[model samples]
Target: MKRVLITVFAAFIALTAAAQSPIVQAHLEPSHGILVGQPIRMVVTVYVPNYFTGSPDFPEFEIENAIVVLPQDRPANSNTQIDGVRYAGITETYVIYPQQAGDFHLPREQVTVPFALAPPKSTIAQVPLPALAFHADVPAAARDLDYFLPTTALTMQQKWSSPMKNLRVGDTIERTVTVTATKMQSMLIPPLSLDAPSGIRVYPEEPVIHDQKTDRGDFVYGRRTQTAKYVIQKEGDYTLPSIELKWWNLSSHRLVTATLPAVHFIAAANTNYVTELPPESEPAPIAPIRHRSLWKQYRSRILITSLCCIAVALLLAMIWYWLPRARRRLQAWQERRRHSEATYFHNLQRACTQNNAAESYVWLLKWIAVADPGVSLQQALKRADNPLLTSDTNDLGESLFAQRIQDYSWNGKRFAALLRQQRKDHRMHLSKHQYLNDLNPK
Candidate 1:
């Protein structure tokens, strides 16, 4: 009996040990060095002895003065043998940007990995990954620049929509500056300042910034565009100030400036457009007449005026009483029309007849949204359970890919009729429910 008890205890210990066995490993690559405001890539690799049937839960980080940017690209999966140990792995890459200069430490991450413990015995194991740590410091050369823009290359150019020559009062001059920086982020680009002489109205537009990427999934360049519009309100010779943007030259190992020369032009008033004022004239003198005879002649006029005022007052009272009622009726009619599937169908048909694919697509989505409020177009079609409507919706979706408008026609009057029938059925169902509720009083 003692020997049997020892065997059972050993078996239990073996099971617990197997359950806690290491199945995955976590690693931070290039883990030690980064510059402040520079982005670093983090890769997490998972390894399973057998096969992984489910994804592991990856927790996000909320560290101080640091942010993690997830790539739009999917995680990479691979199978490899290291030292004759076969393993399946998945690697997830994330970019981390440190805001302040210091040592940043990330806490250990825990992931629940689901895998086949054995044949027909699948289970999940909670695994704790190793912590991530890195040091960030300011660049040595960029310390004195006061402004830093790290990039491989930088170029700036000035553009004008119209000629600045022969400027006139009330005429507008539009100037645009475009800057492109290779191997840099667009958000780091600074704003441009415009200085104009007095009597010139400067209206600066919102600056545009975009990051252009290469085909190999790497950032190629960062572009920033600044536009300002100047309106000449006073006619005079004006000098538009020069613009200078300073940036750190990563390639040259020094600071550089992109300069725009000052522009000078004269603005003359347009004499052809003029305003005329009316001439003043003396008022005619009033002649004295017989007051008694004038009063007698105007007595009937006074009575008629009183009657007309009374009639107007009655009409106003009637309108005041009926106007709100009419408004409510009109609003109810509009609401009903707006929510009706028939209305959307008709609008879609009209758009299709006009050969407007974009408008028709909008109306189709609207009708689907109305039919299934929270469901997407595809889900709504699936829920419809009608092959005809589903086929028509698919065709419509395919038509969007057509290059020319003539190639895409809805040709789905039957689908529209089906929608109308469904709407009618829904209304009937609601009315039935209402009737039952009225009879039961519950």
Candidate 2:
């Protein structure tokens, strides 16, 4: 009887501890029929016994031969009942793209969760995430292609910077090609080859690639833009090669090809075209004797002139190097001073001295903001408790918003004087308060 009781007591304690511990669950969506360069969703859910005091710390991890994307949206909240006990849960999603066909495994990781054990009592728990495995393979139909693109939709567009119909030997034209794909990454799109005929010169620019995402952080589409400039080197009719991109359509499960048509144009010989000429022939050997005679006669003057030229060149080089740096420093300093509190106060005083009601009101608001942040202008005025300042400010407002502007006139000078007096009184009151606080210990 004693042995049986001891065994039952140990079993009960084990069950109680298991009930209080946190739980972690992970799984993949569409676990079968995954293709290369396709995105898969990985959902991870964490649950605590009572309620969560703070969000769970989900770790970011990487898998070999694949691209991992962390959750872009906030965690989804959920509640579930397990073994007759309620559990509060949060779910976070991840996106993974396999670059090649292989088996991928997600290693175990640790997640920290903060939750309330009871009302007003909180604790943190470290939960272990279980390992997950998945497989990706290339479709037999897409095996022959050099690059694999698995998407629901794909499109290609072309634009020219100028008309391609003109016939000129020295004229140049720019051609831009844009490729857009749905449910794929921009980096997976292959580059377009812009090869021109032998007679034409081709200069290819760097390609621009980006992806667009929805508000919840899901990828909407990917776009790739390429540009090339063609210059007409010789006069003749030239034909540019066409471009074709092959991709696998995920919806139809078939291969699709997007093409841009070829371009043909005629180039006529330009009459105004000028060819580079050979450099002038060097002076004959016999001419150096005459040059040497002249050089000997003015050698001292030539030396002096050359030294002066060198000094001037040095001075210009120094100024060229230092001028830009000095200008940037000066501009930065001026910007800082322009936004200072003292500058705003000075502007207010100037506006009030000129008796410009509109300008004075604008500067008054600015100065008040710098003086006391989070306190309204009316509140500050009430705290000052000055009847004259209040009356002048009211008159200033009337001048700004009155139906008839000529009906009311404001005295900015009196307002400025009263404002200064109120500031002095406030400062004196603060000094007295500080003195009293220092005199008595708390």
Candidate 3:
């Protein structure tokens, strides 16, 4: 009987041990690590606290906020079963690429988690995880006698389109350039200037910094683009020389430069058509002399000349009365047509960029109706080109809309992000049309 009691006691102890066999731990390396951009990483371990049981999946975590005085790009990466604990040990990495060369730190910040415990208890507090320290490196400036020489390996790219690719004299051409990089400082990039061809006028588009990202806690990548316009004043094939862009590449620790291929364009001649009589087939036969007196000939010629003068004067008077009225009518019709299409296109462009899947569907239908006047939303959805639009009736109008709870509206963050991207892209396109408009209050 005593032996049986001992076995029961040992069994209870074994069960309890199974319940709390593992624990959770966290860490990162070289806390004072130097990264040109923001770099983040995590270490995970499972600790059962000597009495807790049955580790479930790892708990999720996030940094509440991060601040860096130095320029850096920040992004997050995570992987699990790493540094493994049978129940859990996970690591996450965050990287930031700094734009300026200087020292920066990730101050003590809060880390938050709302997770399912193994048996799912509510609000069991563990000691707060300590914040790790990180340092960011910044860009270095070059002091050179010839500034044209780039000091870094940063590179540039260009893209262009002309609304009027083929133009007559007095027509305009639009050109654009897009620059992308992973480790460039703006100060390292040289200012742009164009040496436009004779008879060509160049108007620059505003340059915009589009989007940026950091990778592996050390490198930064970003896109910058711009547009320009030119008017051709003469008829001929014209060529523009290759454009050179200079930048400094910190990674390579040297001057780097790239040149775009040269460009060629043509203008057409303006031709005029005039109506005239063909040469006579044969010389007029000599007219037999009329036996008329000189006074009769003079009288006939005078009468004919007076009639011609009177007819010409009547024609001039009619044109003076009707020309201005015709010109005004034509101008009014043109302005009205322009306004109608302009408003719709601008609105439609906005909707596409916004990605309000439902609103976009409605706007797209409206645009189709403006074009064909027969496409209903349902029918249009079938033919729409954008993949964001879905055909599933369950999703109805919600495919590309961000996932949300009982959403009657799109997700706020998603909509806001989509809108911001659109606004930036729209501005970039607009900037392609230089000196177009600046909405600055000042």
Each candidate's clash count: 0, 0, 42
Error of 2 at 175 (Å): 0.6
Q: What is the C-alpha lDDT of each candidate?
A: 0.69, 0.82, 0.48
Candidate 1 lDDT over 1-442, as tens digits, reads 9999999999999976564443555555556656655657777767654444344556666678876665432445555564454455556666676766799887776767654455234456787767668898666766775556766678889888788788788787898998888866677777778879998989999999998865434456789999999988788989988988777665565667788889989999977533233466798897887557765889899989999999999999999999999999999999899768678767867766665544565576566556565445555656567787777666665555332335544665554566566667767888999999999995
- State the TM-score for model 1: 0.53
Per-model TM values vs. the true structure? 0.53, 0.64, 0.36
Clashing residue pairs, backbone N/CA/C < 3 A, model 2: none
Shift of residue 211 alpha carbon in model 1, Å: 4.2
- Cα lDDT tens digits, model 3, 99-180, are 3335444434333322223432322324344555445443344444234232224456665564435667767667777666
Candidate 2 TM-score versus the reference: 0.64
Residue range 1-442, candidate 2, lDDT tens digits: 9999999999998888779778999989878899998888989999887655445779888988888888853566666778877787778898888999989988788898866666335577888888889999989998988889999999999999888887698788999999999988898999989999897889999999999977655668999999999988789989898999999999999999999999999999998865445568998777444445777899999999999999999999999999999999999999778856678778878879889765676567557766765444566677878887888887975665443447665788888788778767877999999999999869
Q: Which order, best to worst by lDDT?
A: 2, 1, 3
Cα lDDT for residue 162, model 1?
87
Off by over 4 Å in 1: 1-33, 71-73, 80-85, 144-147, 211-221, 234-237, 249-253, 268-442
* C-alpha RMSD for every candidate: 15.7, 16.0, 24.7
lDDT of 3: 0.48
By TM-score, the candidates rank as 2, 1, 3
